[model samples]
Target: MIRVVLAEDQAMVRGAFAQLLDLQPDVTVVATAGDGDEALAAVAEHRPDVLLTDIEMPGRTGLDVAQELQGEQTRVLIITTFARSGYLRRAMDAGVAGYVLKDAPIAELVSALRRVHAGERVVAPELAMAAWDSADPLTPRERELLQEVTTGASNADIAVRLNLAEGTVRNYLSTAMAKLGARNRSEAANTARERGWL
Candidate 1:
């Protein structure tokens, strides 16, 4: 049997996934975790063949957890609600073997798990297309500034929040806007959000 570890912050979602996997003839849910730290601990304790995790969780992000645990014994599969291109890119960089959307059909998820267990890469095709088409080449600092702007904060407010000078914030915002091809701050925010950049 393919031993699986499930890690999701939402109680209902975690239970549902566990139950679904448990019903599969060739798979078993050996461990379940509600956060990134627990997920890592479970992996160490259970040493499951595959780890299915949500990207955003308390304590440590899924990317961090995956980066830490990815190895010959355990394959990492990231499951997320937000199909952010940046998150996917980071997960891929962390050597995640599979990336599945939370809303994807259970069959797809099962296939993804099986593929990853067999040392194959799995990424949701739709998400892959969207990510490819909407790629925004934002530097880390520019992305951070864009995220701050998404809160509808004034320039001074963002400066204080990010501990950056107002002029520096303006420069970052301008750079982000230019990269996103947006005409104004509001437009930039909207564009970034639409592309899942913020």
Candidate 2:
């Protein structure tokens, strides 16, 4: 059997995925988790052949779990709502076995899981093209600041959270804006998010 562990924040989605995978003759839903940290625990305990996870979660992201489990036996397949090129790039960089969007056909998702479990890389074609077309432009700190901005944090709040001077925060924001050609902070945040930099 191809044992699988699924991680998604939404309970309904998680349950639906579990039920669907469980119905496959060769695949078994060995465990399910509601967040990244729980997913990690499930992986450790079950040591499943495949990990199907959403990229965004409350405790840890699927990307974070993939990074943590790098080079291990468990293969990771990221399924997320966001199909940003940046996220695809990050998943590939972290050595995830597959990356697919949530809106993809269920058959494709099932096939991706099997392919990934069989030691093949599976990336959505459109996302792959987008990832190839756009390179990550933001510095690590700049991306960090953008992430904070995405959470609706003010410049002062970001400065305090990141332990930077308010002026330094502004400088980073400005640099990111220039690099991304954003008109303002909100625009910068939106741009970064769309690019998956945040």
Candidate 3:
């Protein structure tokens, strides 16, 4: 069987996918996780052939986990609601093998998983053309800061959480705001998120 680790935040979606994959004669969901951190743990423990994940989750994004798992045995296949081309580019840069939308048919998703396991790249046709529209301007640190900014956290609170100095946090946020053409931290965070950079 093609062992898979399924990662999605929504319990219903996770359960449904696990059930569906289990029904496939050639596929088996070896484990399921409700968030990115949990997904990482499951993948580390199971060493599955593929990791099927959603883009946005509670802890790390799928791209983050995929980036962390680069050169490892597990191939990652992203299934996300966000259709932004920036996300596709990021996933490609992170070395994920497949990028498919959540609305895609189940057969396509399964096929994509198989293709990824076979060491083939799989990206939705609609998203493939726009993947090079422009590179994401923010660095990984900027992305993390912007994510914290979206939580409406004060710079001091963010600094405390991220273990960075408050001045450093402010500087990073300011830089990100300028790059995104956002007038403020919240706007910057929202813009980055809208573009699937965060």
Candidate 4:
């Protein structure tokens, strides 16, 4: 049997996932966690072969949990409601074996588990498209600037937050706008939000 651990903040969602996975003939729900800290603890205690987790939860994020548990012995499958492109990129970078949207049919979950177990990478098709559409080679400074701008900060505010001169902040923003093909700061912010790059 494929031993599985489920981690989700919502009780109903957790229960539904547990029930769905349990119904699989070759799978077993070994444990369940209501938060990231509990998810890590459950993985340590149960040593399940696979962990299915939601991205946002109390204590630690699912990405944090995945970073902690990534290894040969156990695999992580991220299940999230929001299909944020940045989240998907970060999850992939964290070495999660699978990514599934919460609203995906149960069959997708089962197939993801099977694929992860078989040493295959799995991501939602829509998410894959979003990733492809949003792909841009961003410098580290540009990424940081974009993140700061997403918080609704003014140029001076961003400079203060990043401990840079206001002129430097403006320069960074201009460069970022050029790279993203945005006409202004607001447009740049909107583009980043749409791509989930923030």
Provide the overall lDDT of each model, using Cα atoms, as 2-decimal numbers.
0.87, 0.93, 0.92, 0.87
Model 1 C-alpha lDDT per residue in residues 1-198, reported as the tens digit of each score: 999999999999999999999999999999999999999999999999999999878888788899997565899999989877867777888899989999989998999999999999999987787778766688878877777777788989999988989999999888888888899887888887665554
- Cα TM-score per model: 0.80, 0.92, 0.85, 0.77
The deviation in Å at residue 73 for candidate 3 is: 0.7
lDDT of 4 by residue, 1-198 (tens): 899999999999899889988989999999999999999999999998899999889989899899887674889999998887877887887899999898888888899999998889999999988877767556678778877887788889999988999999899889889978999987887787565555
Candidate 3: 10-residue stretch with minimal lDDT: 126-135
lDDT digits (tens) for residues 88-191 of candidate 2: 98998888999999998889999999999989999999899989899989999999998899889999999999899999999999999999999998899899
Off by over 4 Å in 1: 70-72, 147-166, 181-194
lDDT of 2: 0.93
- Global fold similarity of model 4 (TM-score): 0.77
Using lDDT as the measure, name the better of candidate 1 and candidate 2.
2
Between prediction 2 and prediction 3, the one with superior lDDT is 2
Expressed as tens digits, the lDDT of each residue in 73-185 for candidate 3 is: 99999999888988998898899999999898899999998899899999999888767666789999999999898888999999999999999999999999899899999
Candidate with the larger TM-score of 3 and 4: 3
The Cα error of candidate 4 at residue 83, in Å, is: 4.4
In order, what is each prediction's RMSD in angstroms?
Answer: 3.0, 1.6, 2.5, 3.1
Q: After superposition, how far is residue 50 of candidate 4 from its true place, in Å?
A: 1.5
Ranked by TM-score from best down, the candidates are: 2, 3, 1, 4
